[model samples]
Target: MSAVEAAPRVEGRSNRGTATWMVVPALVLLIGFFALPYLTIITMSLREASTRAVYGEGFTLAHYTTALGDFYIWGILGRTLLIGATVTVISLLLGYPVAYHLAKSRSRWTSLLYIFVLSPLLVGLVVRTFAWMIILSNNGVANQALKATGLIDFPLQLMNNSLGVTIALTHVFLPFIILPLLGNLQAISPDLAMASRSLGASRMRTFWKVTLPLSMPGIQAGTILVFVLSISAYVTPAMLGGTGGRTMSVLVVQYLVDNFRWPAGAALAIIMAAVAVIFVGLYLRLTARAMRRLP
Candidate 1:
């Protein structure tokens, strides 16, 4: 080979070596932590449930059969899904404007605005759930305000139900949706909106036809994130849901820890994982069609 060609090959090899070295740590962590633990969970889920042994003695499909056949478990799954969908919708509705404002903002206080958006996440989740409990209680601030305004005579049953769970979850995951959406919105060129407006379209119409379509990617990502997180959440549901709003995550914890049914818990976990995967995959496919021709 000529000297010049040999030198390029040598440099390419060095670059690939450096890239491989950089990827090793992340690869190791994924295999050791994420992949192995997930495989262990799947293995445990396939085993029989037993009180005598933590993970059970032999493999059986009883756990899956029992869980799937139980009407009560199905009820909890439905409620969990409903809460997740509600929270995702509410969060998107509230988050989009905030994200849009943040993306278009040139104010010096933009940093402060971002902190305000993220302030709820900075607090411990347990603490936030407790705060919701206080506010949603019978004589809590909401009821008291309603009474003061002559809206009602009796205290409302706000906590220990799906409504309370939905409200709290929406508040908790709102920032998550907003951040990704803000990043997506910022990436869209402003000139596209400007050009639409220059063509005699109203600002509202321009945004409706131009900005919203372009922001679908952000919407898809944010909704999926909120949906997954809200469905899998345990603390807020356990605290506010009480008996009426137990989700799959809470049920899994009850079986695994409180009830000493690891195999059952693992089965429930796997079921949830499968459903999440299917739902997210379907979501991606639908959104993919819309985003195929992004300019």
Candidate 2:
């Protein structure tokens, strides 16, 4: 090639080099923080559980074996899955209407409504959990209101249980479901529902057939997100559920902090991560197939 041809090639290479250089910092940060720590966890998980040391010598699968054999761990895992599923379903059920209204409404109050829905998220998880503790306590506002209304003879056992954890978690994760659903609902054209109605469909029918199907992508996204977060949640469960509301994450923390079993904790954490990944993957695959079959 001539000098003129080589000049353009040199300029292209320089541009590519600049782009690579610009991305280097982000790559370094990801590897240093996220990737390295995750790899360390995997490494630590293979070690034997030790009370005195961070990790014991030699590789052993005892931690994983213990997790599998221990009925308490299984119970915690079951509770984690149950709570996560419950929270996801409840959030979706409650959030859909709010999200639909937000997407469809053109009123001045829509902005205010949006802000109100997001207000809970602005509060810290610990603060929100503490607030729930107050509201659900024996002499708290909820019981007082119930008593004033003659709804019950005594205060309900709302605190320090799975119900309290679920309630707080549902509130905490509602916005996650709503935001995604709202985006999906907004992308749908109003004319589709109108057209369905024009073809002799009732409002409910039109919504069931036309609106619901189209909003499924958002539902899938929100459900996966909420479920993952719920399964991994620790603070709300620990604060609200007390001794009975132990989940996988709480168990992991107990192993590490309370029991001083770092290897066992790491193994449990790895198992949690694996389960989440598998669940999400299967869900996505099923959702994709279902969507593809839709007309």
Q: Per-residue error at 14 for model 2, in Å?
A: 7.4
Q: Which residue ranges in model 1 land beyond 4 Å of their true spot?
A: 293-295
The per-model lDDT (C-alpha) reads: 0.92, 0.91
lDDT of 2 by residue, 24-66 (tens): 9999999999999999999889997665777777899988998
Among all windows of ten consecutive residues in candidate 2, which has the lowest summed lDDT? 48-57
- What TM-score do all the candidates reach, one by one? 0.96, 0.91
Per-residue lDDT tens digits for candidate 1, residues 1-295, read 8998799899999999999999999999999999999999989989877667776678998889999999998999999999998999999999999999999999999999999999989999999999999899999999999999999999998989999999999999999899999999999999999999899999999888899989998999999999999999999999999898889999999998999888889999999888888888988898898788665
Which stretches of model 2 miss by more than 4 angstroms? 1-24
